[model samples]
Target: MIEIQGNIKTVGLTCGYRNMPIVSDLDIVLPHGKVSCILGKSGCGKSTLLRTLLLLERPLAGDIRFGNLSLNKLTAEQLKQLRRQTGVLFQGSALFNSMTLLENAAFPLIERAGLPRGLASELALLKLDVVGLSRYAHYLPSAVSGGMRKRCGIARALALDPPYLFLDEPSAGLDPLTSAEIDDLVLEICDALATTVVVVTHELRSIERIADHLVMLADGGVAAAGPPDQVRRSDIPAVNAFFSPQSNAAPLIDPHHGLASLLLDEE
Candidate 1:
């Protein structure tokens, strides 16, 4: 239900602590209720784009709007309100080792939603159930496997029931099967909650499985964008190279063993 009209225009968006420009002239429309994957090679400004969109990094010269509200025009309080409507999952599952799974999941609800501790705990358990991690509620983050930790992170992200969900490299450290599971969970979340999802990823298998739309970033701009099928069919060299199998040079690994191997396995 979020209609992003005109364009999410960025004339000269930049990043880094010194405010240097990592990318520029980035224009994109994230369309409502769709899962958009921002794809790019390493250090091609994909993460910079996501950070700018999330307002974690400032844009050098650009205007961002969500619905009718101009992001730049919003006051600090208003910006906080806007952020409540969105949830973000960082690259590494970013859970606190000191907290149990339930406490980690409930943190946002208690802090942002201002719910009572009892209520927050109840809601967190429910979200954990949704992510199929209810049994791990009492376990510390350090006690779980990598995949479980990611799922815990997902549960925490969903705790607030935000309309927009942003995930950075959801499958970065996992095996193929685990990655596919995360993709399926994302798809299910979108289907069940009708949440608009923006994911930053370099994995083609993930893009093929979960992308409702694709945005390819290169040379400080969007090289191409559309539905996955349309993007694959694009004549643009950058777009074609991105989707082309020949461009994938990463070592194949067994999903179970998490070890590099010579076998070419399909998820």
Candidate 2:
């Protein structure tokens, strides 16, 4: 893993796409070598905030600082150089369907780091082992299950041994067991690589299992920020609603209730 250390700090951040704002006047700190989860309801700008932080999308206002560099002040070449310290796993895994898992994982090292193909493959294989996908290195993404594909995405993200990692909805489409496995893999990555990991997700279970720090957003601003347990216990209505656990109650209506009536709700 790359030897990296730095906290990500935002000052008066306002983020959005085009000219429209999604989140405004936000400030948060992501500690070094920790797993921070960005949590929120749908349409609450969690992903927007992350994209702005990753320098993928420019913020509408405010400044983002990583280590000593101001993201908004960097030149194109400088930004590219700074980006080498980071890796991203997109929501869909985003692997090339035609590339073998090994090739996919090794692409970053070859393209970004200018390593030889053979050496890149060697490094990629080690990353694959880290994510428990070493045996599937030769397979195409299409040939792997969704869970395996996500693991391969993780392997590729670590191929360059980045000190900072960003994952968007890492467990989005998996079953409960598979999602839990992915959560475990995420924890393992943070521990083994000592990477500063930022995960954008709404999966409550995953948050409870893996997050070391939490930033919860409501309507694009911070509703709460703290450790997972503290955020869960917050009296803030939005926080309470989001962290509330599922109940084990059966339906109150008769099993034979008509679909239309159920949909309309009885007066």
Candidate 3:
């Protein structure tokens, strides 16, 4: 990995699109070399907060600090440089349909790192192997299952060996087993690479399985922030309502993707 160290700190952060705020006055610490999950109900601004942190969307208010650099203080060149140091796996997996998995995974290495195509491909293969997609390196994204495509997205994200990784809804649509496999890949990435990973997701099981630290948002601010088990045990009514359901019997569909199946699945 890129050997980045230090917590990503947000001071008085208020972010939303089109000037209206969704996450207001939020102060949270994303620790170095840990997997932090951002969880909340639909429209609660989990993704908005992440986008602002990634500098993909400008925050309406607040300051973000990574190491010694402040987001608002960075020049255009510094902004570009900061972006190149981080990796993002967008909700869609954001792959090129026309490229082979190898080519897709190697793209950032070639484009961002200025590596030769052959060398990029070689390094990309290693990343694919890390996500258990080495055998499918030659397959087109269209030819693989949705789960494989997500893993390929992960491979692509790590192509540049970035220290900070952001994933938006990493396991949004898939069977339970597939989602769990993706969760395994996430754990492996954090443990093996020691990358600071931030995920925006609603999957309770995935959170229980992978989250080293957790931040739960409600009412445009932090309802809870800490370790997963501790956060789940919180007495906040919204938090109780959110996690209390996990103890109940899971429905016919996997409880994780039950927005269409039932309640507490929204977001």
Candidate 4:
């Protein structure tokens, strides 16, 4: 299990080549074995926070630690080992276009684990089966639907069997039905593998479905952090506004009841 404590302790966290500070003085602890969602509007440092945690970007000030290992204390070799314990599913289904689904999934195993091609392919097939994409083994990214491509990305992320999974905007761009399906898949995978998942997304529907814990980001910091119900009841205006359905927001559909309601109405 991953335990983060004593706050993120960031006096200044920046982004980009100019080193512009998007989020500053940020402090939070992401508990282990929980499905935590980082909610924020676009350009509100959500991605920056994720990158900071992964050590992809060096902070201008402060520090990050996981369990007992502080990011500052780890050498290059140690940092690589630490990263191996985490799996990241990037936004836009960032699968390589040239590689088949099987090869895409196997890449991590080969590169990180240094496994032979035969063994890596065997492991990749197992992960593909877990993601319900076994039939798409030979298919390239272009051949599959968007949802399938997302699943393929997930399979590739899981290739190393990381204990923690980070999903960046998992529900972005997908239709509501497909998004809900992805949520269900995330829940299923978490339960089966006992993985801790940290999802960064703005979709309220996705939050309602998959968030075991919630952290709302606004004004360059966390607005609230707790269970979903507790977050809904928060007195903070920012929290309420963040979760409130916007005028153009997609209608909240109960995944289990939607089909039934439609079928019964048609009767």
Q: What TM-score against the true fold does each predicted structure earn?
A: 0.86, 0.88, 0.88, 0.85
> What is each predicted model's overall lDDT from 0 to 1?
0.83, 0.87, 0.87, 0.80
Clashing pairs in 4: none
- Cα lDDT of model 4 by residue, 89-149, tens digit: 8888889999999999999999998999999999999999988899989999999998889
The alpha-carbon lDDT assigned to residue 158 of candidate 1 equals 92
Q: Any runs in candidate 2 off by more than 4 Å, and if so which? A: 1-4, 245-267
Residue 78 alpha-carbon offset, candidate 2, angstroms: 2.8
> Which portions of model 1 show Cα errors greater than 4 Å?
1-17, 245-267
Q: What are the per-residue Cα lDDT tens digits for candidate 3 across 1-267?
A: 223357889999999989799889999999999999999887799988988998888888889987767888987877767777788888889899999999999999999889999999999999888888899999999999888888899888888777789999999987889899988888888888888899999988899899999999988999999998899888887787678766542243565564745565347
**Which stretches of candidate 4 lie above 4 Å from their native place?**
1-17, 245-267
Tens-place lDDT per residue, model 1, 49-115, is: 8888889877877777666678778787778776887888888888988999999999999999899
Clashing pairs in 1: none
Candidate that beats the other on TM-score, 1 or 3, i.e. the better one: 3
For every candidate in turn, the CA RMSD to the true structure comes to 8.2, 5.1, 6.7, 10.3
**For candidate 2, lDDT tens digit of each residue in 153-255?**
8888888778888999999989989899889988888898888999999998899899999999986799999888888888887887777635432334655
Please report, as a residue range, the 10-residue window in candidate 1 with the lowest summed lDDT: 1-10
Off by over 4 Å in 3: 1-4, 246-267
